[model samples]
Target chain A: MATIKVLAKCCGVSVATVSNILNNKPGASAKTRKLVLEMAEQLNYTPNIVAKNLKMQKTRSIGVIAEDMTIFSIPDIIDGITDYCQKQEYQILLTNLRLFKKYNDTYYNKDDYYELVRQEIKKLMEKQVEGIIYVAAHERVIRCIPDNLPIPAVMAYGYSKSRKIPSVVVDDVGGAAGIVKYLLDQGHKKVGVITGKTDSLHAQARLIGYQQVLYQNKILYDPGLVAEGDWTRESGYRCAGELLEKGVSAIFAMNDLMAGGVYDRVEELKQTIGEEISVAGYDDRELSGYYHPPLTTVSLPLHDIGYKASEWMIELLNGGELENAGENVCAVDCMLLIRKSVKDIT
Target chain B: MATIKVLAKCCGVSVATVSNILNNKPGASAKTRKLVLEMAEQLNYTPNIVAKNLKMQKTRSIGVIAEDMTIFSIPDIIDGITDYCQKQEYQILLTNLRLFKKYNDTYYNKDDYYELVRQEIKKLMEKQVEGIIYVAAHERVIRCIPDNLPIPAVMAYGYSKSRKIPSVVVDDVGGAAGIVKYLLDQGHKKVGVITGKTDSLHAQARLIGYQQVLYQNKILYDPGLVAEGDWTRESGYRCAGELLEKGVSAIFAMNDLMAGGVYDRVEELKQTIGEEISVAGYDDRELSGYYHPPLTTVSLPLHDIGYKASEWMIELLNGGELENAGENVCAVDCMLLIRKSVKDIT
Candidate 1:
């Protein structure tokens, strides 16, 4: 807790001289600097970082606002960001808004929700964060952006509807298309689909991808072969049961959890996966790799998205020009992890 | 960014008069205070929080070092901490060390591991956190308290080996005993157990609880009926298979993931759970309620632990004496959630 005044008094010099020597500013003689430093060490002087930050106008810290932390994907994304920040010697001020719970509350209207988010941003600003990163709990279009923000901001796992803020998102459509095409190339015909909530943007985009592949293969798109699911294992189970009744040879579930439900139903019917019926899933979650037959699924590059978002924030902080500052949408590719679940019809 | 100096100059008042009036210090007349405040508001002066914190010698912020964020129980604990901090108007500086990965590295010796942890603590200190909370990835005895720590530190979900630091942990033995007693009351005498890694503190404590009940009921302890698992569904599946071969009527898997594996094996062998054989699990994870026949498990009070740990830190900061400061261990009781997984053998 020793201060500059105490060190200066002990070294028989002015406080400014001791401060200059400590800050490595020229003007203090070598002999004087050496004597001041020795006195500081002897006194166990610890500099006040708050004063230093105020003077420099920078804290070397970034604010990360996570919409919710319970979501399985958000943690991995945060891990990626943390890794990058640690290597750069930057600190993170993380605020979990629990927006998922608020969005479900009837008393909190849309305006109230936005107001809550604005309050969170203001709190971070008061902490003097140089930049901010908004992480969405789910992959959806975000419409709320505080007006006239002074600091650099970026979005991850979601984008702003106004297209005025930069974002890093997964190529959901391409991932769906690639997985469906892989199934088609394996000589599978009459493929059934378990779509996510019909209102979901991801669900609609993935459905379009499935239809496009079917059309290119000269196969007629059958609406009866598609059943709607709510991205739950039970929904997947019910939808897969309905699809089985339609006598489809293959089933493409939009997510791995639903695919697990499909597996459960297949086993119930005295049938084996990858043989009696081919199954594929998306979002290659951790459990997918250990699923009974292993799951053939698409891996969402969440880590890369998180890493790239931090990179963009750092770039903006360094006074680098952002390409397409407004309407800037960076899409990362999804990888297909072909495991033991898909049958080799060829 | 208007400074008080600018406001004072614009209002034609001395800086000391403006400062005293703005701070509501005594000796400033009401009329003078009103005039200074009106002028400051008109000038849109925003007080520099950094300077204020420097003068106060406190940041009103706490550092939370999460050993790993991917663990299922961690997010809920963090959510509890965030909820409490938000209510108390305290900011949290979050740092994810990803120590689980580091512990697995062969090159990272004991000293290196502690050094890494010390480095994380130093970073938070640089941020001027008033207190520190260390969140362990799992429940165990920790030995890595940095030497000569200068801040008040607490642990959540783990304890220090020296017992010098306070910790909040679930009553693992009591929770296990309560659930097993419930099973015994249902008239199941021949019970089997699937335990986690023997080296784990939770595993050993839970095992002791299980044996205590058996001894109380005059049922001889049978090591042959116990199978060791690695806390994974696969290990549960394999161990359950071995236990089933011994014709045990009731099985208690130490965790829900392993309980899930037990369910898979039971179905594979064409046996109905909760009827031919009863199954129970611990750590009532998210999917436990959705499992087929639903799982009867022990719910760890993670939220309460988190809330209490923060309460302890805040108390320490308020200069309140920590009860039993060193060797202080606070244990919260776990609740037993009874579902359809346990059968009425009576």
Candidate 2:
């Protein structure tokens, strides 16, 4: 925080002499330069970029504030963001909030967290970043980005709730529908479903997708076949038995972690998945491939969501209108990975 | 690159008027301020921070160069870096090289990658970061950081091969020895070894650790009991059968992925993992916990390595001598996680 004048006074040298040495300009002898340099360090003479408040302009750098780097969804989203930004020769000034590590999953529910985000935003603004991108660990209605922010801001993997900040999230409805359609096509009329936590938007949308597929097929949707799960492998295992007792030929789990539970239940019943009973899961986690039969699942468009978020940011920076101005949200489609877990009974 | 003079000329205003308008200082009329701002934006005016090169001092920011964020090791490392930095109130300017995505695993073996790193370094230097921390995806003798660099640089999860640039890496030797010692204490004689690729420093160090344990226990080392695995599950499976045939009671896999292969081979023989064949794995990956009986493995000190790397960087920045200045390479200890996979024969 010290100025060159202060450093000069302490070192018994002229301000111009201290400036010359600090700027690497010739004129000061090596001894004077070393003395001035050491003194400058001692005084913490930081020429802060906040000085740019006087004249800061296009930094060609986007400030990315991630909820937590340790979260599973964050890395891929960041990868996608960096991939696109690098292509545009735009630099990334990253700030990891470490919210999850500090507060666990309940951080978002806290009111003070939003204020924390605003602080990070203010710091990035001081650094003169052209735009801002907030990467969330989970998809939810996150109102962290202020509606009246001066610069452009985009949300990745979560809803911002404000029209000013565009949000990019996974198309959970389409993803579940696509996978369920494949399961029905495999000759499974009575397909059991393991739903995620009741409160999750993902769970609700995926259930709608399943109901829509059954409606189109003219099959009466059986509420009995839908067993509640909390998105854990144990919950999936607990729900699978009820569905199997209901005579469903195949089971669809909301996420791969729960699907692993279904496998555990099926194996316990002396039934092999993909043969006696087909299983399909959403979220093709890396562990899904290592599953005994390899799970047939949906891979969330996480990377694409990040890419789209940055695309919207760069567009806004370039003075272009957001592509999803009408809805203010972009839902990226998930890919159906047909591994060995789904059996073709037909 | 547009200067205030150019912006003022374009706005048809005096330089002071333009400066006052851009700096949000009162004096300029609203209409005049709007015109000046519009002209500044049009000129791609950025009050470039590089102008600080004239007198830039302590920015209290460190540049972190990550090889790839998509790698499993990177996020946690970055998390640790952020953890230490936030506590110290220092900012991080992150540059994700995305080397694994661009050049695959062979990037380290390539000649051009070093030049790519130097370019990134230059960009960070221009941003006036006081220090640099390079996070490598894999451990190796990396000479990417130049010795002539003015500011200090630290290597995380890899060796810099430079005394000036302190390196923080996993204590693979100690990690392996600790787990192997646990296995030996369980009354398991004739423990078989499955090593990673021969070229890896991690694999070599781990192998030495296994050997050290055997020698300390007064057990003769047998080359036949050691099987070469290229850090793949398939290779682990291939070697598991051979080690089992050689009549070893327990297997020490170099990594968890390879241990998963051992599980596969054990199941093929219609035997339960812990009951029939005890297994201890390295790098306690997330998937290892999901493995059937779970896995007993060594948890790498990735987060600690990152924390130590930043500690070294801050020390160098604060003019404090590095604690490990004598060795220049500080190998942080790994934690032993006991899960269901390893059985006590005693």
Candidate 3:
């Protein structure tokens, strides 16, 4: 349990000297090395292998960096990494920066935590990790990634919201387009959107997709049709209330959580959902399937994406080509799970 | 990208010689080490640090062994571990056993997978993992864990379900007792339960609590009042149907997933939910609050349990006494998020 500092103090040597002896570096004298070793053994010292390995050749591990670690998307991508790594007998180091939780005054700016991330990556680099997987829960035009990363890197669940690097992402535009097209097909002239925080890249992309659909169909776009939520059911409930107050005949919730909120609020209003008002949601989360009058939602094959990213990461780790015929923008087609929520407005 | 063996071949030396030189072991002569080093440098050989570390002392990383990795409970627990370990700067090695997916055959008994588990653990051991977190998604008892583990170990989600080792679990009995008492106070006499997986410890404990409430109230415990599910919505739907067929007025689903299922099924039958048949669920998952008649379910603070478990593990890691202050059974209290899922059935 004793650290190198403690061992160094007990052996009457500098901390760096103790570190050198433990790492088997050339500078330490034989006597000092022997004395440090004996003292370290007596103290039950565990050298920071990760720190020591930085100078040595290999660590047989990779780092996975994610914006939101708790969300479903990160794990789905991790599943891919795990499967692929297991095949080639590799390991992963997972790091999460809770980007949503307010760490500094700047909202969604992970700049304060970038140093911590870089520190871990430095240890990984020290350990000489072979590769890195950068996973972001929501698409963002992040500005702080260091250019000279020490190893091969892959991005998952995000597009370069600003088009900086190649990323693997679901076809949010196509998926959103499909939903709007469906509503139009149902003869809905007044359809509205319940969306997330406005500044987000993921939300913006979805908005773009929705707008493109309306543009393609020659439908007049209305700013009154859009309402922003915090991506929670409560947000959905409040936003849907505001949208309903605007008198839209149909609503498309950007995610399942918001859709669920819409379901509860609509019921409270004594409005017979799907008959009085059509509704749809995204994410197709497991609960969406069983939502009362089950949610008509978009199903992002998160599991498949997770598995694929990890697989590709393994390929990259093995010195395989980073750019593949199927590599960039592997848009996982989102499926529309129809249930009782949407109704024919015609 | 190239391995040590490939480098050795390129350098005209035995793989052992290359490995010895790379590891900085004194066995390799200076001439051989220098030649191997020059060739490795030329070929850009980076030893796998994880692999190299495994060959040395124990990996400071710990393995989190779980039945299924994708579900809500396990992920929360793992996240808790990750959160704590990241603060303490420890690495985790995750192993998803997929135990729910049976690999049974004529040649392999249930214990066969245990051997594979052992082999995997051995790999972790060879990799030098300092400890293990055995996580069970279900309540089925397992007796296959080897007694002579080389490192510290703990169980989660359920009490060992097999051994009497240290464990961290939610207070299922107390939580269930509270829900039943609440339902009883609401004047429900003929209460029913959509029970969890038959093999689960939490399920068993919950059922006992439900029965205890009936006994305390002098209401006869009826066998027809209970139906079983595999802790999924599909199973909840089927179980609710079975229970409804037997005519229970109110139902308490073991978890939120099942409760959501019950809601969907009852709606499918053209019956008004939270009215014709009242229902409740556990876990208080995020979607529960968004249920059409927002689910009145028990909220198990799983993350709290996970955080506490990591705290305990860290304590153990630091040579702190593994003394239980009669707190080995860390029962996280569950809250009933009241919405409109259940109705008072007299």
Top-scoring candidate (DockQ) = 1
Candidate 2 wrong stretches, greater than 4 Å: A1-56, B1-56
What is the C-alpha DockQ of each candidate?
0.53, 0.24, 0.13
lDDT of 3 at A230: 79
Candidate 1 residues lying further than 4 Å off, grouped into runs, are A3-46, A101-110, A215-220, A286-290, A324-326, B4-46, B102-110, B216-218, B287-290, B324-326
- The TM-score obtained for chain B by all candidates, in the order given, is 0.89, 0.85, 0.70
Supply the TM-score for candidate 1: 0.90
Please state the Cα-based DockQ of model 1 relative to the true two-chain complex: 0.53
| TM-score of every candidate | 0.90, 0.85, 0.72
Q: For residues A58-151, write the lDDT of model 2, one tens digit per residue.
A: 5688999999998889999999998899889787888999898777778977888988998888777766688999999988888878887778
* Model 1 chain A weakest 10-residue run by lDDT: A100-109
Instruction: Write down the worst ten-residue block by lDDT for model 2 chain A.
Output: A47-56
Calculate candidate 2's fnat.
Answer: 0.45
Question: Which 10 consecutive positions of candidate 3 chain A have the poorest summed lDDT?
Answer: A158-167
Task: Put down candidate 1 lDDT per residue, A21-53, tens digits, no spaces.
Answer: 888999999999899988887876767666789
Name the lDDT of candidate 1: 0.84
Chain B structural similarity as TM-score, candidate 3: 0.70
